[model samples]
Target: MSHTQTIPTRSSINPADTWDLTPLYRDLDAFEAEFSDAESQVNDLSSYRGKISLSPETLLSYLKAKDKQFLIIDRLYSYAFQTSDEDTANTQTQAMKNKTLSLYNRFFASIAWESPEILTLTPEILSDWYTKEPELTNYRHYLEDTLRQKAHTLSPREEEILSLSADMSYGPQTVFNMFNNADLRFPSIDDGNGNTVEVTHGRFISLMENPNRQVRKDAFEALYHTYDSYKNTLAAMYSSNVKKELFYTKARSYTSTMEAHLDCSNIPTKVYAQLIDTVHAFLPSMYRYVALRKKLLGVDELHMYDVYTPIIRYDSPYIPFDTAKEMVLEGLAPLGEDYLSLLKEGFDNRWIDIYENKGKRSGAYSTCVYGHHPYVLLNYQGNLDNVFTLAHEMGHSLHSCYTNRHQTYINSNYNIFVAEIASTCNEYILISHLLKKAETREEKAYLLNHLMDQFKGTLFRQTMFAEFEKITHEKEAKGEPLTCDTLCSIYSDLNKTYFGPDMIIDEEISMEWARIPHFYTPFYVYQYATGLSAAIAFGSRILSGEPSALDDYKKFLSGGCSMDCMDLLKSCGVDMTTSGPTSEALKVFDRYLTELESLF
Candidate 1:
C-alpha cells in the first residue's frame, strides 16, 4: 500500500483501471429517475397501511411493494456510501453521501411503523394467513424472528426517535475515525538518508512488514506514540460506545446487551462465549507461535512492529490484475463451473474497480446491491498481496451474487458472521492454487508465512480484540470508569498473553487499542475468528474433494439470511455452534506451523 509520492496525482496509477460506474447507470439523470421512483414509492406506502390485514393477498402485496421500495433505498445508499469510503475528500461525493445517509435514515424511519404494525397481528390471524397463502407461509420464519424480537420492538414513534438519534449514537465511530484518520500524526521516520517519511494508516501495516529492523521498530513506536497522545480521548469515545451498547441492551428486554445484539442474527450467545473460551483455552499454542516467531526472526526480543515483519522468507512478487483474475478462476474452480463462469463474468464485465486512482478507496472490499453484479474497490498496485486481495474480495462478491440471485429481496442481504466465510474461502482456495505454482522452497515458505499471518491476524488477533471488547463492556456494565490507565492496563496485558512472552511488549503497545476502528463496533471481533475458522474447515474439505462438501459449501452461500449462521454452517459440514470448528481450524494452523519449522 506504500505509494510512490513522486508521481503525478492520477497519472501515477495504471491506465488499465477497471472501475467506471457508467455501466450501472447511464448518468446522474438515470440514477435520479431511479431515486425519484423510490421516493415516490415511499410516498405511496400510505396506501397499503390500513389494508395490510385485509387479506393474505393484500398483506403479501403490501410487503412485496415495501420490499421493492426498500431495495431502491438500499441500492442508492449502498452506492453512495461505497463511493464516499473510497475518497473522503471529494466534496460533491461527500454531499451526495450525506444526502444519501439522510434519505436512507428517512427510508428506514418510514418503514419503522411496519414492524410494530405487523407485531400487532394476533397469532390466530398470522396462522390463518399462513394457511391461506403459501407465500405467506414462506415468510413464517421471518415473522417468527420478528416476533422473537417483540420485547425489543419499540413503538413506531419511539423507533423513529431512536432512528433520528443516529448521529448522537454514532459518536464513537465518528470521533475515533477523526482522531485516527485526520488528527493523529505519527513521528516522521528517518527512511535512511536524511529524509523523513510520513507514516499513514494504510501504510502502517505495510511499513511494519518492512524487512529493515529499524524501520519496523520506528514505525511501530511512531504510530503508537501518536495514538498514546490521545489515549484519554480515545478511551472516552470507547466508553461512550460501550455505554451505548449497555443502554440499548437494557432498553430491550434481553438478559444482556450481547445477547440482544446477536439475537437479531439468530446467533446464540454461546457462540460468542465459546469463541472466547476456546481461544483462552488455547493460549499456550499462541505462546508457542510467539516463541517460534522470536526464534525465526532472531530478534533479542520482538516488538509489536517485528510481529508483522515477515518471519519467513518472502518472495515478494508483482502480480498483474489480469493474471490475478485468471488465477482466481482456476483457484475457485471447486465452486463448480457455473460459479467459476460467473466469476469470469465478474472479472471481464468491469465489476471490479482496479488500480489505485486519485480519490479512490484506500483498502479493498466488495459491495453491490440486489439485481446487480457485486462491485469491488481496490487500489491494486501489482503486488502479490493485491492479487490475493482480489481473490478475497471476489469471495465476497460471488457470495453476494449467489445469495442475491437465489433469495427474495428481503432475504438477499446476509449477516457478517457468514460474510467472511465466502471471502476467506476464496483466500484459502487461492493459497492452495498458488502453492502449487511455487517453483522454489522460498516461494512455498513465503506462502505459508502469508497463510500464518492471515490466521494470526484474523483468528488470534481478533480473539484478542474480542477479549478487549468483552473487558470494556463488562467494566462499563459494572459502572466502572474506563480511564486511560485502566484501559491500557487491560489491553497491554492481553497483548502479552496473546502475543506470548517472547515478543517485547514495548510501552507503545499499550496504546494499540486506541487505533483499532473495530473497537467502536462492539462484540464484532469474535465473528472474524469464527468466520475464518468455518471458512477454512469448509474450504479444506472442498479442496480435498470430500463427499458432499462442494454441495454443502454451495448450500451455505445460498442460505443468505434465511437460516441462523450456525445452522447455515451445519449444512456446510461445520457446526460452529460448538467449538469444534475453531479447534479443527487451529489444528490446520498447527500443521502450517510444522511446515514453517520444516522450512528452517
Candidate 2:
C-alpha cells in the first residue's frame, strides 16, 4: 500500500500553530454578548441622523458616537470572519460571520445621511465651527474628504437603499469564496515519490514548485481542468462582480469604474495608465528573462508550469518553518531593532495561524481590529516561496501594528494603494539579504533566481493582471459580454504578450483568470506592481544606509490615512506620479538577470 498524505483537521493542529483569537473575544459566548451590544449601539446611532448639521457640537457628538459604535462593530466582524475563515465549511461560524455582516450593513444604512448632511454645512460655517469645537479639528481631513465627493454624493434615502443593497452586491464574492474554499475539490497526484498526495488550493502552488516536471505538469492540468469544468459558472461569478462595480460607478455618477476605484484613494487615472505604459516599455527585459529561464532549464518549451520551479538547483528546497522565522528576523534587521522587536513579539505570541487545515481558507492575509493585535493566516508548505509569504504578511501585520498604535481609528486603516508597499518592501529586503548571505555559487544563483522571480511575479506578472482588468472592465463597460470564451481569450493573449514567443501559452493557463481572487476587487492588482516599484526604491535606500531612509520609511508606515497616499510616498522620497521608480526597479531586474547569466 502506498502512503497517502492528507491535510489535518483543525481540531488536530496544535494550539500554538493557530492564532490566538482570545484578545478579540474569549469564546463564542463572549462574542455573542458583544455582538448583541453592538446591535444596540448601531441602532442608537440613528438618533443623530437628521440633526447632523444642526450644530458643530451635535456633529462632534455624532462623530464620536459613530466612531465608538464602529470600534465595537469592527471587533465583532473581525472575530466572526476570522473564525469562519478558520473553517469555511463550518455552518455555525459562517452564520456568525453573516450576522456580523448584516450588522455592518445596518450600521451603514443608519448613517447614510452623514455625507449629504455634512455637505449642507457651508465651508465658512465648518471653519467657524472648528474654532468653537476644537476637537472637530481632529476630523478636519475626514470632513474635507467627504466634501470632496460632493458631486457624487447621493440623496440620503438613495444612500440608504444602496447601503442596504451591500449584501446583494457582495453576493458574487461570497458565493465564489464558499465554492473555491469549501465546495471545490481537486484530484490526487503522485508526490514524485511513491506517495500519493491530494491536490488542494493550498497545495497547488507548492506542487507547481516540485522539482519533478511531471509533478508540476500534473498539478497544473488537474487544478485548471477542475476550474475549467466550471468555466461558465466562474465566468458568471466574475461577470456579476464586474456588473456590481458598474452599478455603483453609475450610481455615484462616475464616468468609469477605474476612475471611481482610483478616486477613493485620490490617485489619478494616469497613474494607472502610466504603470501599464511603463511596463510595456520594459517588455523586452521581461522577454530576455523568460528566454534566460528557458535556456537554463534547457527545455524545448517553457510552459506556465515551468515558470515557478527554481531554475538553479540547490540543496534543501524544503525550509523548515522555524528556520524560515529566524531567516525573516535576520533579513528584516536592517529595518532596525524596534521593528524586529515587534516581529519577535508576534512570533512569541500566537499572532499567526501557521498551517493549513481541512476546509480552511487558502492563501494568506493579515487583518486586524483597531484595538487588538493583527492576525496572519498561512498554509505553510515549507517551500522558499512560503517563507517569503511569511515575511510578506508579517510586513503587513507590523504596518498595521504601527499605524494602530500611532493613529486613531479614523486614520489607522491605510488606503489599499499604499498597503502593498510595506509588504513588498519586506520581500525586497529579505531577498537582498539572502543573496548577500549566499555561501556558494549555486546558492547565490538560486537566490538570484528567486529575486528575479519576485520581480517577474510582482512587476511583470501583476502588471499583466492589471492590464487584463483594464481590458475586461473596459469591454464590459462598452456592453460587450464577458463570457468564458471572451475572458479566456483576453487572458490568453495577455500571457502571449507578457511571456513572449519563447514560452508556450498552454490552454490551461487561460483558465487562470478564474482562480484569481483579486479580480473580484476591481483595479487592485496594479498596486502590487506600483508597490514593488516604490518598495524597491525604499529597499535600495535602506540597504545603502542612507541617512533618514529607515526613519522616513517608518514614518510613512505610521502615517496611515493621515495624508493622501501619493503625498505619503512623496514624503518617503519616492514620487510615484512619475515613471522613475518603476523604470529604476526594472533596471535592478536587468542587473540581476545579467549577474545570473554570468554565473551560468
Candidate 3:
C-alpha cells in the first residue's frame, strides 16, 4: 500500500448532499407515479404484437412505442441501480431494484418483436419500407445490423421466453455482487505504526501502497485469503456464467461464443485477437518496468506485493473534490468548449457524489442513462489518483451526455469497443497537467511512477485477464470443465509469464479470479486494455497541442453508436482492427520504463 494514502476527508458527505434528481421527477412519489404509468403503458404492448408487420407505418409506430417504454424503464432502473450500489443492504433501495428489474423483464419479454420479426423481412421489402417511413429511415442502420445477425437469432417465441428470464439470467452477477459487498469479511491489517486497520475493498489498494513491507504483505494476504476461502463457490458461479455463454452461442448456432457476444456490440473478433497479440509482443516492456520499480524501492528483491510501493516518500498534494473538478476541466480543455461546458454543468449541479460517505459504495465509476445528466459515483480521497479518476469517469458521463442529446434512444448507447477512449484520454490529460505543474524531480518521479502503474494495470494486467478469459472459453469449447483446481493452475501459470522470472510468483495468487468481478461477464475485460491503447493514441494527438486532434476527439465523443465501434475509432484516427494502437501505446510504456530506470 502507498503509505501516504489517507482516508477521504469528506467521508461524511452523504448522498443527500448531492444529486438533484428533481429534474427527472419531483420526488419519490413522482417517480412512483411515472413508474406506474410506464408499467401500464408497457402492459398494452401485446395488443400490437401480431399486427407489427401489417404495414411499414404500423411497424415503425410499434418500434417507437417500444422505445418510449424503454425510455421510462431506463430512467427508473438507472436510479434504482445507482442508489442500490451506494448501500446494498438498504431495504427500500433493494425493493426498488427488484421492482424495476421485474418490470424491465416483463416489458422486454412482451415485446421481443424487433429482431426476430425483422430477420424474416426480405431485403427488398425492408428497403422499400425504409423509404416509405420517416421513422424507419432513421432506424435503417439499427435494423440492418439486426438483420445481419438473423443467422444467429432464435425463433421469436424462444427469444421472448429467454428475455423473460433476465432476472434468472443474471444469477452469477447477482451472486458476485452480493459476495463483494455484503458477504465477504476481510482480516485486519497493521499500518506503518502497527495499529490495526480493517481491510476493505476500497482500502485494500490504499494499504497496498504502504511504505512498510509487512503492512503490504499483511494487507495482501488478508484480502486474498478471504477471497480464497470462497474461491470454490465463486468459481462455480463464474463457471455457470461461462456455461450460460456457451449455451447461448450453441443455441444461436454461432461459430463461437466470442462471435456471439461481439455480434451484440457490432465488433469484429479480429479486434480481440489483435489486442491479445499486440500486448503479448510488448510484454517485455512491462517486465522491464517492474524490474526498474524493484531497484528504486531499494528492496533486496520485488515480489508481487512490492509492486505498489511508492518511489517518492514525500506527502502527495491533497486535492479536494471541488479543486479536482476545476483541475479535471483544465486538464480536459483539449476536448473543445462544448464537452468542457457539459462536464462543468455536472460539477456545478452536483451531478457528482464525489466523496465517500458512510454506507456509500466503494471504488469509482461513471453511470449514465439516456435523457438524464450522467452521474459519477466516487469515494473520493484527496489524492492524485482520485483527481485523475474524476477526470476519467467524467469522460464516460459526457460521452453518454452528448450521445443522448444527439441521437435517437436506440443509437445513443455506445458499444464497449470505444467506451474507454474518453475515460483513458481524461487520465492522460490529468497526468500531463500535473507533470507540467511539478516543482521537483521527486514529484515528477512520483507522478511518473503512478502513470506507469496505470499503464501496467490498465494495459498489461487487463490483457492478462483477457487472456485468462480467452483460455477459459477455449477450454469450454473443447468440452472441458473449469474446476477451481484447473482455474488456479491456469492463473498461476499466467502470473509466472506476465510477472516474469525475476519477480516472485506465488502459487496462491492462482485464486486471483475469485476477487475479480469482471469474470462474471465473459470476455468483457479486454476492452480496458484496448480502450487505454486507443486513449493513448487519441490523447497523445490532442495533448500535443494539435487543433485537428481536439476536433477529431470531440467528434469521437459525440459519435456514441452513430457509427460502428471500429469506424468510430477510425473517425478519432485509431484503427482497432489492427494492433497498431496497442504497440504504439506500449512504446510510451517503454519510455516510462527508461525514465524510471534512469532514476535508478
Q: Name the top TM-score candidate.
A: 2
> Could you tell me the TM-score of candidate 1?
0.93
TM-score of each: 0.93, 0.99, 0.95
List model 2 lDDT by residue over 1-600, tens digit each: 689999999999999899999999999999999898888777787788889799999999999888888988989999999999999999999999999999988889888888889999878898999999999988887898888889999999999899989978889999999999999999999988878999999999888878899999999999999999999999999999999999999999999999999999999999999999999998998899899989989899999999999898788557888999999999999999999999999998999999999999999999988988899999999989999999999999999999998988888889899999999999999999999899999999999999989999999999999999999999989999999999999999999999998999999999999999999998999999999999999999999999999999998889889888899889879999999999999999999999998997
Q: What lDDT would each prediction earn against the true structure? A: 0.78, 0.93, 0.80
Model 3 CA lDDT for position 509: 77
What ranking of all candidate models by TM-score puts the best one first? 2, 3, 1
Identify the runs in model 1 with alpha carbons over 4 angstroms from their true place.
Answer: 1-18, 32-43, 122-124, 182-197, 356-361
Regions of candidate 3 where Cα sits further than 4 Å from its true position: 1-17
Candidate achieving higher TM-score, 1 or 2: 2
Error at 498, model 2, angstroms:
0.4
The alpha-carbon RMSD values of the candidates against the true structure, listed in the order shown, are: 2.8, 1.0, 2.7
Q: Tell me the spans in candidate 2 whose CA falls farther than 4 Å from its real position.
A: none
lDDT of 1 by residue, 200-277 (tens): 665667678778888888888888877777777888888888888888887666777678778878788898888878
Q: What is the full ranking by lDDT, best candidate first?
A: 2, 3, 1
Better of 1 and 3 by TM-score: 3
Clashing pairs in 2: none
Q: Write the per-residue lDDT of candidate 3 for residues 214-287, one digit (tens) a residue.
A: 99898888877887888888889888888888887887898888888887887888888888888878888877
